[model samples]
Target: MEHEATRITGTDLDPEAAFQRRLGAVVQAVEERIAALLDDAPRRGEIARPARLVAAMRHAMLGGGKRLRPFLVIETAALFGVPFAHALNGACALELVHGYSLVHDDLPAMDDDDLRRGRPTVHKAFDEATAILAGDALLTLAFDVAADESSHTDPAVRAAFVQGLARAAGLGGMVGGQMIDLAAEGRYGDVLLDEARVRRLQAMKTGALIAFAVDAGALLGRAPLGDRQALGAYGRAVGAAFQIADDILDRESSAAAMGKRTDKDAGKGKATLVGVLGLERARRERDTLVEAAIAALASFGAKADILRSAARFTASRQS
Candidate 1:
C-alpha cells in the first residue's frame, strides 16, 4: 500500500510543512515495520524466539525518536521513483541496526546511560545479559530483513544491501568507530585523539549507517554512478553535520530537553568537534557541511529540495 508521504499536497505552497508531513509518515511506517519484525514468531530456519529477548528488543526499538535514518532511505529512494514498499523494507532494516547500536552504546561497558528517549534504557529496563542478546538479535535480524524478497525484487539488489549493511555495521564501520571512541575515552590506553581523528571516528561510528541510508536508496533505484557518488558526498556531509549538532546539543541542551543525560561527553572527556573547535566554531563547521551537502545535490535540482532541507535540519536540530 502507498504510504501517506506520497499522497501529500502543496509542496510548492509550504515546503517545510510538506517535509515534516513526509517525515512523520515515514516515521510511522518505520515504527510499524519494526513492530512486525520483532514479532514473537520465529521465521524460517530460526529457533523459537525467546520471550524476554524479543520484549527487550521491542522495548528498545519501538515508540520513540524521529526515525531520521529511515526517512533518508525512503526519501532518497523516492528520488528515483522506487515504490514506498520496496524502500520501507530497507528503512526498517537500517533502523534495526541503529536500534541495536543504541542498545549496545548504553550498556555499562559503553556510555552507561540509564535513560534513552525519556525512558529506561534496555539494559536498565531489562538485565544487562538480556539487553546484549536483544541487541545481537536485532543486528542479526537486520540482514534477514535486508535479504528478504520484500526489500528488493532483484537478487543483485538484495545482495548489495546485505554486503553494504555488513560493511557499514562491521569492524571497519560503526563498530570500529565505537572502538576508537572507547580508546579515546581511555578504555584501552590514554591515546589523545586529535580533531582529524575525532572526525574520522565520528564518521565511522555515526556517519556510516547514515550514509548507507542514502546509498541504499541509490542501490535500490539502481542509480547511475555519478548520481550515486553525488549522493554519497551529500550523505557524508550531512552525517558529519549531524554528529556536530549532536555534540552541540550535549553541551548546550538539558537532559529534560534532550530526553537523556546531557553534558556527559564533557564529563567523560570524549573528543568531539564541538570540544575541539568550541561551540561557535562547531556551529560554523556544521553550517558549512550543510551547505556542502546542499551543493552536492545541485544536479538533482528541485527534486532534492527535501534532501536539502534534511541537511539544514541536521545542523539545526535541538536534539
Candidate 2:
C-alpha cells in the first residue's frame, strides 16, 4: 500500500524545520536583549567586586540552547492572537529559570557533570561557589523579569505569572522532580513504578515549567479559561514527550549534538521509560504523548499551527 504525502504551507511548512528556524531567531533576539539588560546592572559596572560570578552567570545564561520552554511560551501566546514581541520577556524569564536549573544540576553536589551545551559546566569553568551563586542569581532574576512592567500590564496578571513561574521552578515542581530522580538512583533497578508515579515525577519535573509557559501566555493574552486549560493540557503532554525523547536521546545522541553529556541517566542508574519498557516501547510512548499534545490543540484551529508543529518537533528532535 502506498501512503499519501501530506502537504504543508504557511505555519505548517516543515514544522520542525520552521520551529528550529523560528526558535533560533527568538532565542538570538532574547539573548541579545537579556545581555543588554544584564550589562545595565550596577554590579557589572563595578570593577571592585568579584566580576567572576557575574561572568559565570552570563556564560551560563548566554550559552547556546534550544530554548524549548521559551519557545513554548511565545508560540502558545501567538495562538491567542498575542504578538511574539509582547511575550518575549516572559519567554526569556522562563529560559532564565531553566538555565539556572541546568547550572545547578551540573554542580558537584548534584549531577557532577563536567560539560553542558558543549561548554564546561559552570562549576568546572568557574569555582563551585561562584557557580552556585550564579545559579541562585539567575533563579531570582527569573521572577524579577516576569514581574517587570514591560512583561505585563495588569498587576493581577503579573502576580499570577510570577506565582506560576515560582511554583514550576520551586519545590513543588522542578526541584521536586530532581529530588525524586536523585532518590531513584540504584533503587529503580528492579522496582516497577506504576504509571501514576511516573506521571507524577514527569509532571513535577518537566510538565511544570511547560504548563507554566503555556498558562502564562494565556494569562498575559487574556485568553479564555477553556483555551488556557486546553493549552495547559497540550503543554503537559508535550513536556512528558519531551522528557521521554530526551531519555531516548541520552542513549542515542552524541554529546556534541546534545550540548550536554549523554548516557548520564544509565550511568547514574536513574529510572526512565527506556529503562522500564525498553527502547521501542519508550519510543511508542513518546509518539502517543505527542498525539495527545496535538489533540489538546484542536480548539485553537489554525491559530495553533505553530504549537502543533512544536509538538511534532518534540517527539522527533534528536537532541
- Candidate 2 residue lDDT tens string, 78-149: 766667667888989998999899988999878899988888999999889999998898888788789888
- Which ranges of candidate 2 are over 4 A from the true structure? 1-17, 43-50, 186-192
What's the lDDT for residue 129 in model 2? 91
- lDDT per model, in order? 0.91, 0.81
RMSD per model, one decimal: 1.1, 6.0
Per-residue lDDT of model 1, residues 1-319, tens digit only: 6767778643664667777778888888889888988888998898798899999999999989879898899889988999888799988999999999999999999999999999999999999999999999899989889999999999999999899989988899999999999889887878888889999999999999999999999999999999999999999999999999999999999999898999999889798998899999998999999999999999998888888888888977787
TM-score for each model: 0.98, 0.90
Regions of candidate 1 where Cα sits further than 4 Å from its true position? 9-12
- Any idea what lDDT model 1 has? 0.91
